[model samples]
Target: MVANDYQYILENMQKELETQAEKVGELTKERDNAGKKIGALEAQLSETKVVLDELELIGDDATIYKLLGPVLVKQERELALATIKNRKSHMETELKRCSQTVNDVSKKIAKEQDNLRDLHMKSQHVKQALMGAPQQ
Candidate 1:
């Protein structure tokens, strides 16, 4: 009866470990995706800053062409500046959101790792008991 109980416990622990491992895999993917998004946003922000700086250096008489799809539409300098600044703000906000998501997913992955370790230890103890050995 004791051996059967130990066997049952080991089986249950194995299932739980598998589930936790799957969860960790999912969280890791999410974290990676968020990191990629952050990188892309940062690159866009840098490009936008450069364009904004160039606009500032240009004289008021300089004509600015805003790209609309495949067409370059003539736009006032002030309007172009406003549009670029708004895009930069939006990208910044998205970057912050992605960063927070990455942090949250990382914490979840750590917790799942801890659970997996505990489950592994329990499984080892059960196996030892089944073998008629003293469980250390």
Candidate 2:
């Protein structure tokens, strides 16, 4: 009887550990994606800033034959900033989700450890019972 119970507990613990590992793996992938997205957004913003700087350097537009597209240029900068903000928001949400998943994984690992402890205790109890049995 004790052997069967021990086997059952071991099987359950193995399953729980596998599940926790898979969750951690998924969280890692999601975090990597978020980081990549943030990097792309930052690069776009930097490029837009460079364009704006060039526009500023053309301070005396009247001296130039062609007009300076200040309005359209500012709009481009504004849109770039907005895009950066949106990407940052998305990254923040992804980070939060990853944090939650990590916490859940920790809890699950703890629970599995507790289950192992229970199985050990039950095995000991079963051994004691078998030993206490009288001869027929």
lDDT of 2 by residue, 1-136 (tens): 4656656755665665566556556655665665566566566656656655554555443232222465322234444445546655665566566556656655665665566566556656655665665534
Kindly report which residue pairs in candidate 1 clash with one another: none
Question: Native-vs-model 1 lDDT?
Answer: 0.89
**lDDT, model 2:** 0.56
lDDT of 1 by residue, 16-96 (tens): 889988988999999999999999999999999999999999999999998899999999999999999999999999999
Candidate 1 off by > 4 Å? 2-7, 133-136
Clashing pairs in 2: none
Query: What TM-score does prediction 2 earn?
Result: 0.46
The per-model lDDT (C-alpha) reads 0.89, 0.56
The 10-residue segment with the lowest total lDDT in model 1 = 127-136
- TM-score of each candidate structure, all chains considered together: 0.90, 0.46
